[model samples]
Target: MGVRGLTTFVKNPSYTHDGSTTLLRPHQLSNTPVVIDGKGLLQWLYFENDVDCKHGGDYREYETICTEFIEALHQRGVKPFILFDGASNPDDSKVDTLLGRCRERIQDSAKIIDGDPESPKLRPPFTTAVFLKVLESKEVGYVFCDFEADSEIVALANIMGCPVIGNDSDFFVFDLTGGYIPLSSLRWKEARQLSIPCEKYSLDHFCQAYSMRREMVPLLAILLGNDYVSRETFDDLYHRVIKRSGNIPNGPNVRIPRTIRFLQSRQNFADGAKRLLKDEARRQGKEECIEKSLQAYHIAPESRYQAYLQQDPSMVDIPDCPLPAAYVDLYRRGAFPADYINLKFRNNRKKLLPNLVEDYIRPSCHLISQRIREAIYGILLHGLHDRAVQETGREGQDIKVFIVTGMPSLPEFGSLPNLERMIDLEEERRKVLVMEVLEVDHGRVQAIRDDLKLPVATTIYWRSKLDLPVTESGHHLMRVILLGIAICYSREDLNMDDVKGNLKEAPRVMNRTAVQAFAEWQSCMYYTMHLNTLVNRPYPTPDATKLYHGTLLHRIYATTRLQRDVNPDWVETDVLRGSPAALALFRHLDGVAQNQ
Candidate 1:
């Protein structure tokens, strides 16, 4: 979707990273806003749960994704600026195609829902009105782009000298040089701050990787097609006006390299497109092909930019990268050219531009990956706060003990002998948190829970649902153990005596899908913890399979997080909010099966 065939053609993805997988602390930078993509965040929220909102969810359903994410950033000392795309698409040509794809996905969703338990469920993309309203409710800063938010976000990131946080790889095509973060990498896994580098890829590295001039990349994208334009459509446009001199055999992906060669020849797009068309026509004996190819060229890139910008002019007035509506005119008038090759030598730089011919991806590029590693730990309650306080001492309170379960025992399904090595691997990097995995596994959850003498604040970082289909008894047992600890300390905030007596009065929770039910579970947990009435909540009831799900882990931690609240006794809902599992954590398939 980025530059259709670009990622594959390049062979080498430009990136840099430190060998360490430990989470990074967010540094407070003045005048730098962490740009967020609203639609991307919505998907993260929807998928993080067992929720099935594919038929499309309403405002009340998805509002928490915004509220929780904003607060998470604030807590880490980041000023997040949100961006949403408007309902207008300047190019109407794509609606039918986009709708077609959406319909296909919706059909798939229906099959998944009505068919097998293992069928993959997909949510359909919808308008942003509901998400925008939530942003307004919280009084957060945001802007609706005229067409799409990709270019706007990149422009803003460059203007602010900050980082763009999103999942879209198209930012690579935009030449987002200053900074970029995939939104999925910012989720809360182990309660760590999201740390990503300021620069994802520079122009130099991109050119080197693709083995072509900079201008050719976008041209290749036009030929290969991107989100706005389909590759088949672009090919059709090219085939319509062309005369075949001889019916040459079409080999595998021969056009991609040929297009790259054609684009690279002229150094400038306008000159190159005309020249390529001319070259083709001379060989085919149809001189008219050049004119037809040029016409097709004008529709894309600029019109792609225009259709998006004219829908909303206020986009240009953004505080960070305020460009007037005139730029779109400039774009259309052919004032702007994708001339990376010529500009490199013409103006000239003292040094050749950046390229990663090195083994390590530059540390700057992998900042989000490292940050995501830590976030997953925190979100998963892998003693993230405990570790953060040890390193930063910002959180006044910390965990005295960890009740971690689901340590990797079997190596055959592909867990390794080195628990320490798990942190080095990408899959376990998000889920596994251990100084030494073997030591933790040896300690055992029951042993730790039974020992009970070593702690004031305790937490669970168990891989329950991921490990097994949890039963009702399992949930009750986990609740009893944690509540027993609370009762032991006589944590008056939980109203131990009162909640113990009122536990029976807590209503039965049902009548909702797993996603909605989990949301309610999270919401209730937040309220209960914010109100300091954890004990008043019902005892955990394990459903044989449902209780085994890790969704309840979020519920439990939301309640426990109040212990770190500035005023644990007072209602501070601001600090207790929803989480983005996509950003902060990742899971491994190795130990997730029935036996695991």
Candidate 2:
């Protein structure tokens, strides 16, 4: 309940290319800082990237992920600073409760009995030690904070005049005028796809649109409940405030309401939070004084260098390193910011389409479109134009075909002469990537490794965050279409029930999570399908009440209706401007044809 459904309220579909003169595309330009929340990223790598600590038989997988993330930022021409949570501030009243957890962590660290110096557990658990190793190896700079990584991320982003990357919804609260990129928003593979129509956003726009800093984004989050605050207590208080005041707080003049008048003198968040606790206590009719129990909420976005460096002079200095050569080439070549997808809603579908536009659909379509674009163009690159050979040993050349299978699917063809050159999918397994050799090759019974690094069909276990809506259905469906086209297979290749069964074991998916299942069916139908147009950005919900349905549900309805209105089964779409992937393919194909 961090920020409690604020994502729904702020990410309005209407705030778009059609209405606003500009949409935030921060990573598109040069000199923008990327502030990484060490915590947010660790969770993403473990969960979404499907990695875990297992290096040195001591769980060092996070190091690999940090390196990859840094590489991605470097490719966008942004040197990043990582801020890692150190200790909770000693002065925070919440510090007492956290002390117990910290004690347990200390005990946990002491218990690590690793003899190997390289063992990640030997350093410390949950303290950014592993990520530190990766950063040092890469000579990447970072901040080692004394508390609250979220606040640090915000503070650093503001100070650097740059964007942020991590999954936290709290970035919006920090007033990130530069912008923010949710790790979920990234295409993860291709560089050009970074500019997919939407996703990047400036919090300055959010503050302006919402009509208040109110200077209370963190206060709102405190009330909604995080690790320290009880959300249920706040919820009860909010209803009572609504019942008595006969007014919700979103309107103007919420300035120091009388219910919390004890705090009107300061009109600041700390006292407002104290008053909230007192109100809850009053509603409960407890004579027990809550003033002593009042903890100063510590979500405030104050920075290290900016806030205290004048006196402290203790800013952590990291060794500056040369940027990766491949990244330099990519930046010089230039990247495209997604051109706005200006779309007009059909009259009949007006109720269904609230903020449907080009930018909105970028998140869902960007990944799939890039993968499909690569799979199709890899044929031109390797099969038609021999580009793979020319680009051999180049970083980012390895194409992994992500699929899902619990068994050895590729080894069945191992006896074939052409297949002999292929690395065994069964060898050197990793999470989700049961068949991939990863970027670095490992010990295998067969000496033959993925030396050529040709676009191997990198299969991943089928999992999705469908209930989240904005990212679910379209992403799942697009993958199905991708695998289908790359291998020239149809519906027969997939077992719908098996697909459902695999995803059923995954956490965070919805009940009977049918999108991935359904995508299997569509992928068969869309085998040869290519977008005739740029994928229209999907809309988020207009009605905030049903936010759980998310953008996934919205796109499922809109995209299907669109397909029905135009081509019943064709997944191909048309656009005034080509998607980056499509545009790349056009140029590649065109270049080869011209040479011929």
Number of the top candidate by TM-score?
1
Off by over 4 Å in 2: 7-30, 52-63, 91-128, 193-198, 243-278, 281-303, 306-596
Model 2 lDDT at residue 464 = 25
lDDT of 1 by residue, 384-490 (tens): 22322111100111111112222222232233222123223453331122212211232233222222311101112221311212222233323423333333223
- Cα lDDT, model 2, residue 558: 38
Expressed as tens digits, the lDDT of each residue in 1-596 for candidate 2 is 13444454444322232354333443453345677776667656655654422110112344556677667666666676676554333334343344434344333322321222342221212213345556657766554444456666676677667778777666655667467777666665554634322267775664454333444445555545444454565556655553254233354323223222322223445555556666675675531324322222232455654432223333433113122333222111111000100000111100000011111211321232223333323322222222221111101112122321111222322211111122232322221121221111222212222321111121111122122344334343433323222212122333434323322222232222233233222221121122101111011101111111122332333333323221212322221022334333323322221222
Measured on C-alpha atoms, candidate 2 has an lDDT of: 0.36
**Positional deviation of residue 387's Cα in model 1 after best superposition, in angstroms:** 63
Output the worst ten-in-a-row residue range by lDDT, candidate 1. 349-358
RMSD for all candidates, in order, please.
24.1, 22.0
